[model samples]
Structure formats: C-alpha cells, structure tokens
Target: MNVEHGVHDAPYFVPSPSRWPIVGAVALFFFALGAALTVNKVAAGWYSLAGGLAILFWMLFGWFGDVIRESQQQQYGQQVDWSLRWGMSWFIFSEVMFFAAFFGALFYARSIAIPELGGDTLTRQLLWPDSQAAWPGNSAPTSTSYTPMGALGIPAINTAILLTSGATLTWAHWGLVRGRRLQLICGLVATIYLAALFLALQAYEYHHGFLDLNLTLASGAYGATFYLLTGFHGLHVFVGTLMLCVMLARASQGHFSEKQHFGFEAAAWYWHFVDVVWLLLFVVVYWL
Candidate 1:
C-alpha cells in the first residue's frame, strides 16, 4: 500500500508526523484543568489557563504557517483545492449551527422564559413577579444594567468598513484570476489594512462600552449572552484579519502567482464569510 503523509491520496500534502494534534490535545487538557480549578478558587488555575492559551496560540501559528508554506510550494492539486473548499463549506455550516443555537436561546428567553417569569403566565405569577419581560437591548430582567449597542453609530460604521473590505478582497480575487500581480497585491494590502482598522475600532468600542456605558459581561443574562456571541464573533474577525495580513505578507514576497493561489483564495473566502456573518449580526444583534 502506498502511503504519502500517512495515506495516499489524502487531502492536501499534510507533512509527515504532524504534531499539531498532540499539541492541541495537550492544550485542551490544560484548559479543562484550569477551568475546573479556577471555578474552585485554586491559585494555580490562572497559570494553567495562561499556559494553555500560549500553547494553543503557538500551535495555531505553527500549524497554519506550515499549511501556508505547503500551499505556496504548489504541492496541492485540484483534488486538494476541492477538498479545501468542501472543508470550508462544512466549517461554515457548523458555525451557522452554532449561531443558530444562540439565536434559539435568545428566542426562548424572550418569547417564553422572561414572560412567564414576569407573571404573564398562570404558574409563574407567584415565583418571579418582580422580573420584567423584555427584549435584551430594550430592557432586560432586573439582575443587571447595560446599554444596548445600537447600529446607528459605530456599529453601522463597522458594517460599512467590513463591506468595503469584502469588496477590496473581491477585487483582489479578480486580479488573481486575470493575472494582475500589482492589482492583486494592492487589493490584498488594502483589505488587510481595513481589517486591522476594523479591529482597532472594535476594541475602542469595547472600551467605550465598558468605561462610558457600563456594559459588561457580568451585568445580566442579556449582557452575558450578548458578549458571548459578539465577543466570539469578534475573535473570529480578528483571526480572519490575521489570515489576510499573512496573505498580504505572502503577496509581498511574491509567493502566489495568477495560476497558483489557493492560499489567497482561501483567505478571501474566509474573510467574505466573516463579513456576511457580521452583517447579519449587526442587524439582528445590534440593530433589532
């Protein structure tokens, strides 16, 4: 039996003896241990969490860099591209399901739990009469106070910025397909810069929310869920921005050409996906 990178005809040229799996598993183990201990007031848990985060970040950097290097070497074929596209599609699908769960939870809280708890129902009248039934941003239960992040201000500006970045990335993809190296490089650079700006602005927004608006994750269930969802999405945006930045770096190094540029395409796909998701999030989570 022919064996290449542990299996013949495997997706992409996964280098032999990949260590990311072991690294990831060990990091996860530490993360769990730290989480458990932290909940129990153990002093060493914070150190464990820090170590796990460091290891996880290191693993991601190394593993993704290796993949980027391999792709630039043109060891991947059409079959490999197909496999990658499929993988991305499925990954996005899983993300959709993840967000769907949160949306479902939101619906349950607003449509059922809150109303019932506020004595809108026959059985809950005696239990939680002091609670208020309201949508998250407008008004929430009495447990916490927070201001809703509206879409008319910075959120709208961020939407425009992300949309523009998406457009520039599309232009870059066009340049790649048409064999315009300068155009491709310019477009990639613009997109990367915009992404960075978006992240910086987001951080500023978070600071404003905390310092001025008193919006915090610990404020209430609304604040908790809002931060959990938007915070995770922001983390993804940060990651996507980093991916684009690396693509820009590779573009500058003349690593990708018109004919062979799957790495560029993959980053574009991921960024576009992030932009679309942000649009929805802005409308649903921030605006409405």
Candidate 2:
C-alpha cells in the first residue's frame, strides 16, 4: 500500500482538550434515568424519557457540531474520512438487517401462521372456514383481520415526492461538481422541502388510518404487524430527512466540493435506501 495518501485530512496530533464527552455522558445519564422513570409515569417515567431525549439531542448537537468544526478546519485526514465512510456503511448494513428481521416476520405471519390457522379440509376444516391466508386483509375475524392501505392514494404520492427529491439532490450534486454554488443551494432547498412534504403526507395517511378506517396498532395481529412495518419505515424517513437537512446546511456553508463530497454521497445513499424500503412496504404492506 502507498505509505501515505498525501497530507491526510486531520492533524497528526493535537492537544487532548475539552470535556465534551464527560458532559455528554452526564447528559445521557439524566436522559436514561428520566426515560426509565418516565415509563412509570406516576413514578416519573414520562419525565425521564423526555429529559433523556432532550439530553440526547443536546449531546448530538454538541458532539456533531464539534466534529463538523474539526472537519471544516481541515483537521480531518483522508484516514478519518475513510473511517467515517466505513462506519456509515456498517451502520446502514445494520439497519438493513434490522429491517430484514421485520420483513421476515411479516412474511412468516402472512405465509405460514395465517394459512395454517385458517386452512380447511379434515383437520384444516376444524381450524376455521375454508379461508385463504391473505396478507393484510386476511380472512380472520374482523377484529383480527388487518386491511392494508391503498397504494394509489397517499403512498403513491409520497413515493413520487421522494423520487423527485432524489432527482433534485442529484442535481445539487452535479452543481457541486461544477462549482455552481447558487444552483447547488437551490437544489438542496428543493430536496429538503420535498422530503418534508413526504413526511407530512405520511402523517396525514396515518391519521386517516386511525380516524376513518379504524385501523390501528391495537387492531390485532394484522394491525400490530402493519404498524410495526410502516411505523419503523416512517421513522427512518424522518431520520433521512434530518440527514438531508444537515447536508443542506453544509452545502450552504460551502463545505463540499466536487472531489470531497462523500458526506453528501452517504446521505443520498441513505435517502435512496429509505425510498426503496417505503416502496416495499407500500407493495407488501399496502397494495399486496
């Protein structure tokens, strides 16, 4: 291997300064303690969860702000950049596995459990009526049968919005490549807006589910699975949106150039992954 990749991004060595970690740790302690207590509400579980969340956010702001400053000051080395990439890649991989587990559970429930429980003929006949194991709208009792959302309605619109945002982000990337700062800024703005819009539409859809269709997490096995799949995906979307906002902030500050925009690349990868997951959920959980 090449002995060195030029003058790396970060400094060779610096003073071990700052007590951020200790403060972050203390903040986390409050957050965790608050969360645990808040769970018991009357015992303060709710307050604990709230306080912990606040502390967690505080830590993130201070911690990431410090890293951003270091990165911007050119204290980061190519090695540091590579490390960030690998860490993000591994995190995304873990997220994939997490979703895979949920999807697997969904598949088993739809394909195996429901079918076996509602089968007919001989012993099957003793099970229930000659029922077919359906995905959402299974032939189970009304109380347990869960109906998926319609694909053409809000979900399809959300999908389109996300895709369009992805395209805009690509344009922003190109603008960065060509060093068109103003155009890049516009692209980032558009992407962020589109992401926010997608989130709003999803919220609306969830409201419709609860108020109009009476479908909810408490509906039974079907309801439970539906929420488990869609809820987590929605949370991911929210997270991806925040990442895009960060990229936008960095872009506006002229942090990236055509050659050193891996941060943007990683965020885009995550957003695209979020989009793909939503599609799968729409089809398997909604349309299917």
Candidate 3:
C-alpha cells in the first residue's frame, strides 16, 4: 500500500492489468459482424454468431469470477469502492441516453413525420394518396394490414409485474442491509420469478401482435416504432434478470455483507431502472 504524504494519503487499490477488456472487445466485434452477416443471409453467419456469443459469455464469466475473488480478498478499499460507484453511475447514465435516443425517434415519427405526411399534398400525391397519416399510420408502402396494440391487456399485466418485482427487490435490499440472509435469498428468488414471468408474458404479447393482430415491423410507422421501443426494453429486462441471478448466487454464497455489497446494489439499481423504463414505455408506447 503506497502512500504519499502520510497524513493526507489513503490506500488506493489499482487492479493488476487484465486481458478481459481486449477479449471482450474482440468478441463484440465478431458478434456484431456476424449479426450483420446473418441479417444479410450470408453463409456461415449463424455459426459465426454462435461462436462469438460463446466467446463473449466466456469472457464475462472469467471477468466476473476474477472480480468476485478480488472482492472476497478485500482488495478494494473505500477509494476503490467509490470508483466503482462512479463507474456504475456513468454506465447507467449512458444507458439512459441510449434509451432516450429511441424514445426521441418515436416522438419525431409521431409528432412530426406522421402528421406532415398526412397533411402535405406533395407527400400524399407522391407516396400515399389514399393513406391517412393517423397514428399507427397507414404509411406502409405495401398493403399489409395492421392493428394497434392496446395498453389494457398483457402490457398492463407486465406493468404490475415489474412494479411488484421492484418492491420485492427493495425487500431483498432491506434484508441484505439487516444481515437477514434467508429473507434476502427469498426476495431475490421472488424477483427472479417475477422477471421470468414478465418475459414470458411479453413474448406471448409479441406473438399475439405479430401473428394474430397483424402488427409487425413492416405494418407501418407504428409497427416500426412499437417493436423498436418494446424490443429494446425487453432486451434490457433480460440483461437485468441475468444480473439479478448473479447477485442471488453471490448472496447465497455469503459473498455480501451488510456494510459492503456494491455488486448487489448495482444489480438492484439496474433492475429498478428497467422497471422505470418499462413504466414509461407503457405510458408512451402503449397508452398514448
């Protein structure tokens, strides 16, 4: 533990250099390339994508294992903890901006593009003479039927599930802080169960929308925005569920203490964020 002028100095833990970042980056490159190729129907793309996903999963497992070991060793001091907090905070902020972009696109398409297309004579003459630029607007170049999804069905149920999950997560956090291991474990299990249920119901809803209701990515502007927003949010929920599972495993292993457990805290924060985002999605994408 190196210290500068003894009075003002504190031990700052700098982890030894690791190869995980580079490995992860390379894996992501392959994943992206393979995904693009798959979308274009290139040969071997599926295999390439599967391989890349396997490598990425390996990298995450190794990297997270190392971190857990370091935490167990108490290698991280308050300084390191503060650094981790700041890092997670910034990462979450970046995620917020990421979702904001898609929301903005939805806004633009609804408030500006759809209205203009419906109102302007030139657009009507050139593109859709008989189409009305109403929401879930009939802007598709082809004649594919579409039905807008209502907020009163599976979406409403999912909202209730997310809200309940958030409450259970808070209960788990309380247990963690109070050193009640059983309560913490139970709460986490409940949260995970709820998340799985949410995902299942959402998948069912998507199926209903696509296959039964004739709502699809190509239905019109509404279809495009609808799927884009819900799809990305669903992905976030999936990632958050994985994080919660990891936290649950660590909690069961006695890896977290009352005063120190940023791993769990970070996961909880992310889950709460996912919950908040879904609420917003319900209001804007589904209700409005």
Q: What TM-score would every model get versus the actual structure?
A: 0.85, 0.86, 0.94
Question: Which has the better TM-score: candidate 2, or candidate 3?
Answer: 3
Best by TM-score: 3
Q: Which regions in candidate 2 have their CA more than 4 angstroms from the true location?
A: 1-24, 120-132, 138-147
Q: What is the lDDT of candidate 1?
A: 0.79
**Model 3, span 27-123: residue lDDT tens:** 8988998999999999878888988899999999999999999999988877778789999999999999999999999899888777767785787
What is the C-alpha local distance difference test score of each model? 0.79, 0.78, 0.90
Q: Model 2, 1-288: lDDT tens per residue?
A: 123345554234242467677777877887777766666565676666677677778778877787777767666666767888999899899999999999898888788877786665454577556566655654345565444568788888988898898889889888989999888889989988998898888889989988888788777567778889888988988898888889889988889987888778888889888878887887788777
* TM match of model 2 to true structure: 0.86
Q: Model 1, 1-288: lDDT tens per residue?
A: 112443445544545678998999999999889999999999999999989999999999999888877777677866677788899889878877887888777667667777766656764566555566666642343555667667687888889999999999999888878878788889988888888888888888889888887788766666666777778788888888888888878888888877787778777777888898888778777877
